[model samples]
Target: MRDLPTFDKTEIIRIVRRGYGIRVQKIIPYRHIYRLETNLGTLFFKPFHSKEAKLQLIVKAQEHLKKQGFTRFIPFIPTLNGKPYYCYKKQLFYLTRWIDGHPSNYDNPFELRKAVHLFARFHKAAKGFAPPIEIPDFLGKWPLMFKKRTLELKKCRKNAQKYPRPTPFENLFFKHIDYYIEQAEKAIELLDKTDYVLLSKAGKRELPFCHHDPAHHNILITSTNKAFLIDFDYLIRDLHLHDLASLIIRNGKASTWNLKRCEFLIKAYQEIKPITPEEFAVIHAFMTYPYDIWLLARARYIEKKPWPLTYYIKELIRKTKNEKARQYFLDKFLYSYLLL
Candidate 1:
């Protein structure tokens, strides 16, 4: 690992000891993580920086899950005053018992299946969790957001057309703009056909919490075949379909949009928590949105990051190549679930 920021050992030790009332014997650093060996047990200390209110809601959500007999999530070690986090020198920190596992390897089918299964369980356990703190709900705005992104892509296409001398990135974007626009339009059209508003309202009644970022990196698998979900930074009260879509999108992109792998993941998740037809429709709509392409457009046009334009153009080409396979997979899977 490259050089990481040096942390004050004495200060960390004091904080850990004060938080858990344990004696820290040693502190070992590993790639932005500090392992603390203490008389009580091995603990991992990581920097936590977020709005205090948001942090409180996360802690409450985890605690709620634990009470529901879901121990896969890493629980926050309370400070001396029973606070879930500690603030020192304008930095926030939290500790949790060290998990003896490695990041889930998506290449290993067994590991991938276990991760998907555990993710479904996590979503089930996360249901009915009412946060003590109030957080804004944006679940109802999904359609609006999808339409907005579609409009933005149209605007980008127009701007690309008007450029006096289009750069390579603009040229590549224009090349695929038609296909991308078609996808955005399809997403909006399908979204309009579905009762997404009603679904969102009904979903609010149950109030399922989603680990908005359920990528493979967040899943940990042990040698004994046990899986645990680690980070909850993006936890929010949204439909569980959001989490399912995220897993499929992340894994599908990595696997070049493999249809069988996508189906396997969906089946694995369904074995634990079955998805209704309405939910499946929303998932299809979510998958149809060209989120990756939109991000590339934003970075190249709006943000104007200094990264090489060719890199993103190449990515777009790769997506274009995989587009057929992705569509085939979506159609087959959606047909199996929704039609049959």
Candidate 2:
């Protein structure tokens, strides 16, 4: 790395000693994460980017998982004072013991199945969590969420137009933004047309929670074939089919969007915990949504997350360049699985 900022590393070292009572042997920065070597073991440190209330929910959810006999989740290592997080000058940080494993790659079929199995286990364990009064249930809000995100695409387009001399990313975005917007609208239309979603509204505890962002790096498969879930940042009381859709889409791309590969992954998950046809409809809607391109747009334009411009250009191309393969794949999956 380029020399880190003035206050970040120093403050982290100071907080680690004062709060966790551990002498940091070395600190390696991976984007926003800190991998530290300590006397106890290797651990990872990360700052809370969202509300402290969400952090509270995550801690409770993980505790709930443990009580339900779920052992694969990495726990948030507490401070010396037994607090889940350490506060220093208004910044909050937490730690977790690093697992000795490699990130699961979707390209590897065996590891993909293991990740799917562990994911199903996670969903099973996350069931029956009567969330605290403060934590919100998202079961009925998914339709509204789909609508909102679709509307956000219009706003993203307007923001892109405001650029006087549009960057390459913006130009590339303009080229395919309409197609993705159509995809988003298609998702909303599917959800609205599906009679199953009528039950999705005003339902209480009808759905299991999800690991919401179960990216490859978040799942680490060990030599023993055990998969550990690392990040607990976006846990929510949503349909676990959203998680299944995420798993399918990520791996679908690796399989060149092959329908058989997608079917196999879904089969692996069902062998552990079954998915209903209603859930399949919702998953179909989720797959219809252009999540990858939308993520890049929301980060670079909407949230203005300050990611490097080159990263934006490269990722946008990678996500949109193979549009034909992606669309054909979705059509095959829709006809085969969701046609009922």
Candidate 3:
């Protein structure tokens, strides 16, 4: 919370009123979650690090969704000046209609199946909407991120040496990161060869109509068993596997999903849109992307990467607690993405 600013209910209400031209009786800000609530409804808001590029991308995503007739997405609100984005205290802000539905956690097979199906639909629908706006290159900092993370892992190891009976997870992570670095070149090659990639001639892969970050929490399930998606902040063109890989990795650690559940999702997704064989070949590498994020988080923690490092730590701990989660995810994701 210290890394970001806050807006009181009254403050948020004024912003909403001006942006949407609607009055609200109450406003509650969910700081950790990128959303603001008011009596009129829940209006999702994301504070851009005052980056105009990020703000414009969000506006573009909203407009793209609207044009495509995708109803399951959160709609954006215009600012007081009739602009899709606005600046407040040097931070860019955008509002969207708060979607009313319960967020699914994949506690059961049905929910897990539904989650995958919905994700597939999102991918299929997104491909149809050609965004005229150009997205700013945000993920291009990965090489630097990797270098910084290597240093942080060293610090973590150093910290562990001074402490008696250090955390079990830290030692395990030490092995994971070291092993990942050893195999980094292989992983990169696999990524390059994967059929799921939409690469351009310059060697940079085509960013899939990316959801940027698609965790279970960003998925919403309405009472009618319909799913809606939110949080377009991470929307950029990138690897498609990045989306499914992160979802499977995150959920597999927290809960165990049966093979049947996994199959259903993949089947449902294929029904809506198709997956390529090349993408199937690299399911293993995709599952490892979270590890990449962990390395970045470790690096950013020590170097102070100018973004919240706590989320990284949280995800790391999450995977650590479910030590075998990655293997299970690969098993299911590969089985689904490749076999069934």
Candidate 4:
């Protein structure tokens, strides 16, 4: 609905000439994605940008699976010119086989259980799949963001008197900066310089394929109970616990069954591939990391990155109020897993 760059109808026609019909649809980032409806079938046309490198990594990841004969995913193919993607009017475009299924955001407990079990199975299946892609370094990004926020908050405090009345989170925000930064630093230290989680301490075996972004919304459930995970954008190798923690933080609270549903999902995932005692120990700590991420997200708004300051403040207050959940997990699970 917002203003988008005009695309070439000729390019759309070219692809359609090859027996696919073209219809301009939504413009999405990462890929100027288009929904192409052809008489033959419907599929997605995605043009890569500066993001081609990440997509290339994903494509390379598919090679590992293809060699082993897994076909659950449709990998990106290189064009005849040896380019993994195509360019059109200064924009890039590639096509993917459209997967038919509904996105289950796990609003219901049953769906949440299904999604959790599916992720566990997917991780287990990718255990032997190997790729040559280097894991991205997240340590620097987090610290840079934290530092930027600290400075911004400091500056904001200096001008605090200019605003007639301080918002509700105004006081709590200052009080928690040091605490959040300390926790953020602790997490950054734990991240090793690697492409994936070293499942093997000797750095021998790579951790299972991580969906990178493991929100419940990315899951697609077929009528037959099969779940297809779409979106490989954030796929990286990291501690399997990272994915678990992401799922818990982003999707756990949204589940209809609340704590009961979350417990069921975790238990189901454990049954498919048992989590190690060592990994289990830090699960609580990992779960709490999202709160830190949330703080950073809020900071982005406060820094005037297009997010509304009022909404961000409201969310900050809500997350701060939710600290008890993190503390509960720490008291109950962190002690059992990490401090044991």
Assess every candidate by TM-score.
0.91, 0.82, 0.71, 0.73
Q: Is candidate 1 or candidate 3 better by lDDT?
A: 1
Top TM-score model? 1
Candidate 2 structure quality by residue, lDDT tens digits, 1-340: 2343334667778889999999888888877888889888899888776678888888888898899899888888889999998887777789988777999987788988888999999888887777663665577676787788877887899899999999988888999999999999898888777654565542354545778887888889988888898788777777677688888888777777888889889899999999877777777877888878777888877999877899889999889877899999888877877785
| lDDT (tens digit, per residue) of candidate 3 on 258-335 | 455445555666776675676557555555444643455355435545554455556566545544644565556666
Candidate 4's residue-wise lDDT over 118-181, tens digit each? 7786666655545565656332243354356545544555554355676555566666655555
Instruction: Kindly report which residue stretches of model 1 are placed more than 4 angstroms away from their true locations once superposed.
Output: 1-6
lDDT of each: 0.82, 0.82, 0.59, 0.58
Model 4 regions more than 4 Å off: 1-11, 15-32, 68-70, 77-84, 127-134, 137-169, 175-204, 207-209, 255-258, 290-306, 335-340
Question: Which one wins by lDDT: 2 or 4?
Answer: 2
- On lDDT, who's better, 3 or 4? 3
- Give the worst 10-residue stretch by lDDT in candidate 2: 1-10
lDDT of 1: 0.82
Deviation from native of the Cα of residue 2 in model 1, angstroms: 16
TM-score of 2: 0.82
Supply the global lDDT for candidate 2. 0.82
Which residue pairs collide, candidate 1? none
